[model samples]
Target: AQSVSQHNHHVILSEAASLELGCNYSYGGTVNLFWYVQYPGQHLQLLLKYFSGDPLVKGIKGFEAEFIKSKFSFNLRKPSVQWSDTAEYFCARPRGGNTGKLIFGQGTTLQVKP
Candidate 1:
């Protein structure tokens, strides 16, 4: 039995601010980590993911995440934020094997003010 947890409930920021969303998971074997974003009126889209490469993986919209096996954590980070970046983010990990089935965390809403 494995699950994902997102510690942040809601986050607010101004334009061009730094952003980081905490994400943790409970699993004992190799797992695929993912960060997904849902815009105001759009479908869920992937931000970044890490499987078996370098610990750090980059995604679209200037987003990146680091996979730390020792920590069982994969935190999302962005150097700067923009108004367009305002969205709900979810940290997810696959259930069982790498079959593309994801167990998502409690979503975190990010609001970027001007």
Candidate 2:
């Protein structure tokens, strides 16, 4: 079965702290990786994505993700995080043959303090 896994369920950091969230997928074939973020009281928003071009793709709010096909991993990273960055982040992939459907991993809650 294809699924996404996030190693950390919760993370705490102060302002200007570095952030890295591990995400791994269990698919042997091609894949499209995505990172979604849901701020407090906000709907999910696309953080970053990787399809086919460069392995490292950048997205909104200084966030970026790198896809390592050899390891079947797409990890999210940020050099420095702000208190406003606090949110629940999700790693997702489209279901096989159903691009409209997504399989998301158990979200990682990021609590950034001022």
Candidate 3:
């Protein structure tokens, strides 16, 4: 079965610290990768996505991710995080084939201190 896996359930960091979240997907065929973030009391928003072409993509809020096809991984990264960056991050992959459905991994809660 195709699914997304996120090992890190929670992370804590101080302001001006770097952040990296691990994400892996299990799917043989082509798939679209996405990172969604939900700030406190806010709706989920897309951080970044990788469909084709470039393996590395930049997203909103200075977030970036690299897609490794061989490893089936798309890890999210941020050079420096702020307290406002505290949120729950979700890694998702579409089921593909007309369904237009996305399977998300266990969300990771990030707490940034001032």
- lDDT per residue as tens, model 3, 8-114: 99999999999999999996666899999999999999999999989999999999999998998999999999999999999999876767699999999999999
Backbone clashes in each candidate structure, one number apiece? 0, 0, 0
Candidate order by TM-score, decreasing, is 3, 2, 1
Runs of candidate 3 exceeding 4 Å displacement: none
Error of 2 at 46 (Å): 0.6
Per-residue lDDT, model 1, residue 59, is: 96
Model 1 agreement with the true structure over 10-91: per-residue lDDT tens digits: 9999999999999999966668889999999999999988988799999999999988888889999999999999999999
What is the C-alpha lDDT profile of model 2 across 30-99, one tens digit per residue? Answer: 6988999999999999999888989999999999999998888899999999999999999999877756
Q: List the pairs of residues colliding in candidate 3.
A: none
Off by more than 4 A, model 2: none
Model 1 misplaced regions, further than 4 Å: none
Query: How do all models score by TM-score?
Result: 0.95, 0.96, 0.96
Candidate 1 worst ten-residue window by lDDT: 93-102
